[model samples]
Target: MADETESGERGNVKTGGCLCGSVRYEVRGELRPVVNCHCSQCRKTHGHFIGYTSADRNDLVLAEESGLRWYQSSEKARRGFCHQCGASLFWEPTEGSSVAISAGTLDAPTGLKTVRHIFVAEKGDYYEIDDGLPQFPGTMRGHPLPEA
Candidate 1:
C-alpha cells in the first residue's frame, strides 16, 4: 500500500474504543474517507444514518475485546459492537478483507471527511440529505468513489 513506509507501518494510525472502553482498537492503516449509509439496518442499529470509514482487516488490531460481540446482520455482512455499552463499532463484509469502522466510534480529529451518501433510496422519510454530497440510490459497489 502506498501508505506503508519501509518498516511496513502505514503512514496513518488511529485508535478508538467503545463507550465503556470494553472494545478498544488500533488501526495501523489508512482510513478511507467517511461514507454515510442510509440503509434501514444502519438506521436501526445506530438510531440514525451511520457514517463509516474503512481499513484493511489485517491492519486492524483489537487492543481489547472482552465485551465485543458480532451479529450477522445479513448473509453478506456482520456487525460488531460492544456488549457492555451497546456501542456499534464495525461492519465487515463476509467476502472482503476490509472492515468498515463506525466513524463516530473513532477518536476526534480523525482527519476524515464525509465523502458520499449510500442507500439513499431506502433512507427514512423524516429527514433529508441536504449536505449536497454525492448520493447514491443504493450501495457504492459499482459506483465510482466521490472526489475528495
Candidate 2:
C-alpha cells in the first residue's frame, strides 16, 4: 500500500470479516489511511507486520462476534481475533479511545492507502522499510498521523 489522497468524507460504509466468516464487522463514517505497524506484538498477531486503518470507537461496529475473542496483550491494549480462523481483526486501546481495523480484512475498494509506518524501530530484520513514507518509532498518535 502506498500513500493516496481522498476527498471529503463520503459517509462511506465498509464491511470486513475473518477468513472463516466467523467475525464480521461494519465501520461507518470516514476511516484513517492505512498505517503499517512493525511492533513485535503486531507482527506476532498477524504473522507479519499489521496493516490497519483506524476510526473512532463509535464508528466501528461488530456485526458478528460469535467466534471473536480478545486477547489483552498489555495493560493498555488488547487485540481482537477470530477463535475459529485465528485471523487478527482489531487492535484497540484498553481505554476505548479508538480501534484499528486490519486493512487486509476490509472489503475491496476501501479507497485507503498506506500513509506511514509505525513502531519502525522494532521492525523485524527480515524485511526492509523501502516505502518512502514517514517511519515512526512510536504509535501514529505519538507522531500525529499525517494527512491522507
Candidate 3:
C-alpha cells in the first residue's frame, strides 16, 4: 500500500517486526517476489525451508532494533535475528545489492507470491515439493534447470 513517509512522498512502505516486537522494520519501495530456499543451512536455521523477499539495503529502515543480533552464517553472508524472540529474520550477503527478508516476518497482505524454489538438491528428504513451481538444484544466478 502507498504510505506517506516523513519526506511527504507516497511510497510503497511495508512494516514488520519480530515475535516480540523488539525488532521492527520498514521497507520502502517494491520488494522482490518470494523465493523458497531449501538449502540445508536454511532448513537448519528456520526449521524448514525459508521463504524470502528482498529489497535494496538502502530501502530497509530499522524502526526498532533493540533486540537485533547478527550471526555470520558463512563467509559470504550473515543472518539477522531478534535475540529476544529468536526470530530468524534476515540473510544478507557480504556484498550484494539487496538483503533478503524472511517472508514470514512481514506483516500480512504482502501482495507477494512464492515463485520458485532454490537449493532443491539440499532440501530435506522428509518433504516433497508438490507446488509445481520451478525448482533449481542450486541458485538461479548461473544455474538454470536442464530442459525437461
Candidate 4:
C-alpha cells in the first residue's frame, strides 16, 4: 500500500469546480498523498472528515475567475470557496510549502492514497475511523511520532 510520506513530482492534471460547476482549477504537479483530517473544523466544513492532498502553489492554476472567495480561517491559513454556491475548494497557507486541494475536486481519477488521519481524538462522536491508518490526536505540528 502507498504511504503518506511518499514523494514524487506531479505532472499536469485537470481539476475543478463545486456541485454547481461554477469553479475550475488545474494542477501541474504530483498530488501529494491524501490526508484524512478528523478535526472538528474539517468535519464541520466538509460535513464529515476531509480528504485532501497538497500540491506546490506554483503548480496550482485556477482556470476560471468567478465565484471564488477566500476566508482567513486562522492567522496563517485561509480557506477558499465558491462565493455563489459555497463549495469548499482549497486550503492554502499564508506561508507554507504547498496548498491543499479537496481531492473530490479532481476531474480525472488519480492514484493518490491516503496515509494518515489527523485530529483523531477530536473526531465526531457519531463516526468511527476503522481504517487502521496512523492517527494523530492533534495538528501535524503539535506532536511528533516516531519515524516510520
Candidate with the greatest lDDT versus the true structure: 1
Q: Single out the weakest 10-residue window by summed lDDT for candidate 1.
A: 1-10
Measured against the true structure, the TM-scores of the candidates, in listed sequence, are 0.90, 0.88, 0.89, 0.83
Instruction: Name the better of 1 and 2 by TM-score.
Output: 1
Question: What is candidate 2's lDDT per residue for 33-144, written digit by digit as tens?
Answer: 9989999999988789989998898988788889999999999989999999899989898886689899999877688889888899999999999879888887767467
Please provide, for model 4 over 23-64, each residue's C-alpha lDDT reduced to its tens digit, 9 standing for 90 to 100: 877777677788888878778888998988888999888878
Off by over 4 Å in 1: 1-11, 146-148
What is the lDDT, from 0 to 100, of the residue 119 in candidate 4?
83
Best-to-worst ranking by TM-score: 1, 3, 2, 4
Clashing pairs in 3: none
User: How much does candidate 3 score in TM-score?
Assistant: 0.89
The whole-model lDDT of each prediction reads: 0.90, 0.84, 0.88, 0.78
| Model 3 / residue 47 / CA error / Å | 0.3
Model 1 Cα shift for residue 126 (angstroms): 1.0
Residue range 33-52, candidate 3, lDDT tens digits: 88899999999999999999
In model 2, residue pairs whose N, Cα or C atoms come closer than 3 Å (at least 3 residues apart or on different chains), thus clashing, are: none
Question: Lowest summed-lDDT stretch of 10 residues in model 3?
Answer: 2-11
User: Between the candidate structures 1 and 2, which one is better when assessed by lDDT?
Assistant: 1
